[model samples]
Target: MSHALGIAWDMWSVGKVAAVLLVTFILSQLLLSWLHAVRAKRIDRKVAQLCEQSPKHECQSNPPESLPVTLITGFLGSGKTCLVNRILAGDHGQRILVIENELGAISIDHELIDEQAQKNAPSGVIVLKNGCMCCTGESPGSELERVLDKLLDFSQGDSASLVFDRIVIETTGMADPSPIIQVLLRSEMNGARFRLDGVVTVVDAKNLMRHISPQGPAGFLRHRPEAEKQIAMADLLLINKVDLVDSAAMVALTCALGQLNAAAKQLRASHAAVPWKYVFEPELDAVGLAQRRQAALSSDGAAHGPRVSCVTLTAADDVPLDALQAWLQRLVQERHEDLYRIKGSLAIAGEARKFVVHGIHADIQGTLGGEWGGEPRSSVLVLIGHKLPAERLEKEFARLSGSGRSND
Candidate 1:
């Protein structure tokens, strides 16, 4: 009877211990769940606060170590290739990688890159002749991004020490740089690995007046819209073939360019002869850009003229991706001819990364940009088109993102 009693006590003790362990585990799991909820709330609050902040607010500065890139864009017959040759033949000591983006079967520029630049890029120049860098390919991201992905993989390159310190991209004559800039800005891979230093647009001075407007007797032909777009987006404008144009024509062309983009500094030269300093110049800091914007506001000339206009739309909340896509598609389809380009960093519901979107006329495409990281998770979009309904677009985007205000 005594042995039986001892066994009963032992069993009771074991039951008590088991109960304690179960209760501890349950409590721990509950604590973890609570902590996660709290963390999520904190992140949401941060996003809300940042959304209310200024657009010029700098979230995080680019680290000093990432390779810097200079993008060259221009209309056909502009000395863009000449400028690339100058860069390739430059005496700059840094190792460089040149990306020649063309739509043709053969890349003449790739062959035109002299042996000196090849010495800088021991792996040789990369040619992405499939299509324009901004246009959508079979993949979600731009073809340029795909090329960037491979080059940025430092471990997979030929040698650690021979890694390129700088990159120069020579885009096709008809290229629009806005989408390319959007890609660079949105890609976290680029964010971590490369810095898009700035865009330098080379203009054809000899053909400027002829392309700016219809000069023929009938006046049926329209102006070269791409020329103005290219000029407007540039941080620096290099007017090439200046020797071919008279002083009065040069002055007129310069004035037109300034009116299109009051922000960019202009230089005149023959054969794309620009200094190495301007070729690889960094973009203006936030303060400088703000000042430039102010200057543009105070200018006397009509900005962008009547042929083309650019509008910005911004909002604070996230929306369903499919609904947003459907709405945008219908809008783009209806206004395909009028809308030249559409690009945005969008906030999608339940998504961890920002949805970066690019549209050329009717062809709208999007892909996962990157995690929010340290930046504010607000939606900002740029629409470049002919006579855009800015106020209407602002209101629509505002309503879509649950914001009462519009940045337009």
Candidate 2:
């Protein structure tokens, strides 16, 4: 140590000590890079072996066109999963593959699956919790590529049905979206399979104030970057749980969130209840959602926990317009307060156009969407709430369509 340092600490000058420390840091970084490379090479070899043993599971010879990816980030208790569920439930004709990224070592979703179910889980991974799967693993350098390859693999020579239209990644409340963004947007390989759609941030209206702090330096917004940049760097801000607060409180929360990210679209939502169109609109489709995204790419990037139930009711036949409308109206009128989110698409009995359905507390609305064309004329409704009676709702939805079908 002395030989490297050149002098004892007591004898060393400030400049000399600083130089030594700088050299030490460089060496440490080099060592870390070497270690990472070694680990990555080993992972590559193992993956190669697996592919060789099972050629049908090999990565695609030609990667699919880039799929848009939406990153869902929020503070704990901020309703990230609620948003996720709403998206998955919506029959928007978009095949979305969701990746649930948890911060800690154990995956709550994985733990719930029994051994057989785990083994039978689809080849494409939907959840990669434990270190956000971005910053940890044997091959940090190519982990995202490897995951995407497996999920998008078309080894069976039939490629038409195996791809996803989009991917949505939900991060743990404590995660900073910055690192995840860097790993995704900055990588050349990631660009081939994915383009960053936008960053949607969910904030709890009633508890947002508790997480804010005085503005710090370096482009911190007036809402000044607290709650782990979950609010500050948002592209789309969902001021969720608005039903919990009064108008005055809502205004205050809205103003604070606006100051944090004035450029972001802010929507007041109760129970993450938002229409698929509004939530997934192509508002950012052009070379646009680009500027802010670029700035975010250049920049840097908790928890509440909630358990809820999701029930999906599907019927093969078309739903009678009157019966469906009456059913939804009654649902919102009588039980909307208990319902967290309700959204789906439907095929009205005689209507050629698809039907868009969405409802929040005390309100439900539908729009005549495009024709189903070759797609099945079926109705799927998803209900997310606490302690829901699945059987009753399922039966109601089935009766609307009046068809023999499986209900799960």
Candidate 3:
């Protein structure tokens, strides 16, 4: 009788265990089913919403068309801010949102610009503080989704009609654009909430040579990989600061750029002044986007091969016209290799109009800009190069301008 009792107890325990397992499986299945149903409904709702916004078309079971996203990338000090500012200040007839990623502890780039312009601007700015979007050894999907949710909510909520026309992401100078591109591609796969329109890269025409040239042993480690990746991934390349480089230099740079990224469409500009339509509304075909994606993916990690620096000088007084011209000519001739770029607004004696000057290597140009503004006329020049004699250049400028004083 004791043996019989033991067998019955064992059977009871097994039955209880089986019951618990069955219940748990059922609960898990139910949860998964509910989640799948929720996802389906959400996708359906998005599809309906997209149909409402767009022209009447046959709706397949696929996800809706996503918000267009334009990525703007470049190396450090490559006029990215100027390009973004132009987009914000433009009259594109549609609202835009900008995602700004910075590499420093604090986001001072936004504060340095004019607040009023931003306040009145068409684009609403969002900043990702402290870290770069690409280099943190983490996927950008979660971070991007977190910020993009705001735009999604605005569009999908009660105000469905008020949707942002497009989104722009301005990456940090040190950022690798491949990871960022992958993030958007993933988002599209999950649901077409965001579609990559194109990548617009700003190349500093004056400093590009320095960034691309081969570095020696001492400087090899100092090269920038991000710069090369940026060029490789660009669908639209803006060779900015064109005024700084002469025609021959421009031709040579263009040829080199084609070698770097043959797929990208190139545009030349000064002060990032390309038309908003060209940068924002590029003629992007499916093949073009795919090619650009492949180009980015194919590049194994490579560092930027050049070392460059920037030097800025200011003159508070007016300079003689002939002296200014001769000084700039001589400076270009002497420091052509070391001098990558020079741009400035000069206050010249006996001249009603200000001289807008740009210099690249041995090429120098000075054009008469409009009249001076309300403030006193002065000369402000920014020079970029591999190695520059900052103090000597400042003193020479002072001597030429007859100011006896210059600030950097």
Q: lDDT tens digits, residues 65-96, model 1?
A: 66676878989889887777566555766556
Count clashing residue pairs in model 3. 2
Assess candidate 3 and give its lDDT.
0.62
- State residue 393's C-alpha deviation in candidate 3, in Å: 50
Clashing residue pairs, backbone N/CA/C < 3 A, model 1:
none
Residue-level lDDT tens digits of model 3 in 267-314: 888989887778877653323423432443344433222344444566
**RMSD of candidates 1 onward, in order:** 21.6, 19.7, 23.0
**Model 3: clashing residue pairs?**
224-304, 225-304
lDDT of 2 by residue, 216-242 (tens): 473124332336366644557888998
- Cα-based TM-score, every candidate: 0.51, 0.45, 0.46
Q: What shift in Å separates residue 160 of candidate 2 from its native position after superposition? A: 12
Where does candidate 2 stray beyond 4 Å? 1-65, 103-161, 187-191, 214-228, 282-408
- Which ranges of candidate 1 are over 4 A from the true structure? 1-64, 102-161, 187-191, 217-222, 285-305, 310-408
**Model 2: lDDT to the true structure:** 0.57
